[model samples]
Target: MDAFLFQVLAGLATGGIYASLALALVMIYQATHLVNFAQGEMAMFTTYIAWSLINAGMPYWPAFLLTVGFAFVLGVLIERIIIRPVEDAPVLAVVVVFIALLVILNSTAGWIYTYTIKSFPSPFPKEPLFGIRYMSAHEIGAICVTLVVLSLLYAFFRFTPLGLAMRAAAQNAQSSRLVGIRVGWMLALGWGLAAAVGAVAGMMVAPIVYLDPNMMGGILLYAFAAALLGGIDSPMGAVIGGFAVGVLENVLGAFVIGNELKLTVALVLIIGVLLVRPSGIFGKVHVTRV
Candidate 1:
């Protein structure tokens, strides 16, 4: 049972990372009714920025904060410059643009960083935290950080006026505009928040996955599975889905198919969920009158 306990704890830690990215995905979708296919690449780019800052002698925490801020600005700029032009375009056009962004970011990172896999420093110590044998310090720290982020987001959306405005804009832009809210800017702010969240995920996972342009690719897939499993439209559902997917992935990888086929597990989950219940575990089915 000791071995099982350890794996579960480890899975929760990894799940926190997946949950963070899944939350980002859900955030953008909630605001714009579109999935940002470039989210993972965007995260990879910001993570590289963090790496560069650290390499340039900036302290770890300072670099992290700066990178997150940079990511927020980048997201806002992309929304205003690239996405705004196509806000009312066909879904296909938007998808194409998202793909274009993914390719551009990936290529740019490879060009600048040379596709080299670099080591990322962990803010947590190597020893087990609190003298616990079941989990390492980084794992515990990662989970705490994820929870803190979630709590802050909850408070923001539930309490702050700007957060309420953003929610209203997302729910009904026409109504929001009627009520004197800047719907366009709210959407831009949503993008910025999503990018910031994704930056945290990238940094948290980097120490374990190592730093590379393609690092977030597989992680992104798992996050998709988590978001879909939990319901793309529900933030709380995404968090639950993230933890569930994380545990499922680790357990299955350890006992069933082996780590070699772990990515396949995520693919299977995505396909299975789409086939069986497209609405997802926590998603609501909407009906429109013809």
Candidate 2:
């Protein structure tokens, strides 16, 4: 029982990382109707930036904040300069661009960092909690931070005026523009927010895993599974889906099967969900106007 509890706790910590990135995926999908495959690469880049700051003697917290800010601006610029021109193109084009971005960023990072493994300090302490015997303090801290970030995102989308504008743009870009909302700006803002969220995920997971250009690749797969399982278009779905995927994967790996099949489990879940309900749990099916 203790071992089970420990695995559950550990699952939640890892799930938090997946959830953060999944949230970003949901955000972009909601706003622009396209998935940014480069999202993980962007996060990895910003994480490297944070590492550089840390290596230069800056504190972890400050470096993290600075890296997030930098990511936000970088996102905005990419949207304006690279994505805006092709906003009205076919879905394949956008997807291809994201793929291109992924390749470019990954290559750039590898060249810059020499593809070596490095360690990063966790924002939280290393001690375990009072009652938890197997879970570390870092795992607990990850869960707490994930919850806080999720709450903030919920509030931002629910209460803020800009958030409303972004939502409006997502629902109907043409109508939003008719009502004076700059749909382009809203799209850019969405990308910026997604990048920032991805950066947070990268930072949180950095301590648990080695720092490398490909560090987020596996997490990205988990996030993709979580987002798809929960409903790619729904933010809340992503959050719930992330935790579900994490728990399911860990439990299945530990008891039902071996660890080698974890990725397969996630893939199976994603495929099963898509087959059962193409629209996803929380996604609404819409009929296009002819």
Question: Model 2 clash tally?
Answer: 0
Q: At residue 233, give the lDDT of candidate 2.
A: 93
What is model 1's C-alpha RMSD? 0.9
Model 2 misplacement above 4 A: 288-290
Each prediction's TM-score versus the true structure:
0.98, 0.96
Off by over 4 Å in 1: none
The digit string of per-residue lDDT tens for model 2 on 159-240 reads: 9999899999999988999999998899999999999999988988999987998998878888988898789998988998
Tens digit per residue, CA lDDT, model 1, 154-260: 99999999999999999999999999999999999999999999999999999989999999899999999999999899999899999999999888888788899
TM-score computed on alpha carbons, candidate 2: 0.96
Superposition error at 231 for model 2 (Å) = 0.6
Q: Provide the overall lDDT of each model, using Cα atoms, as 2-decimal numbers.
A: 0.93, 0.88
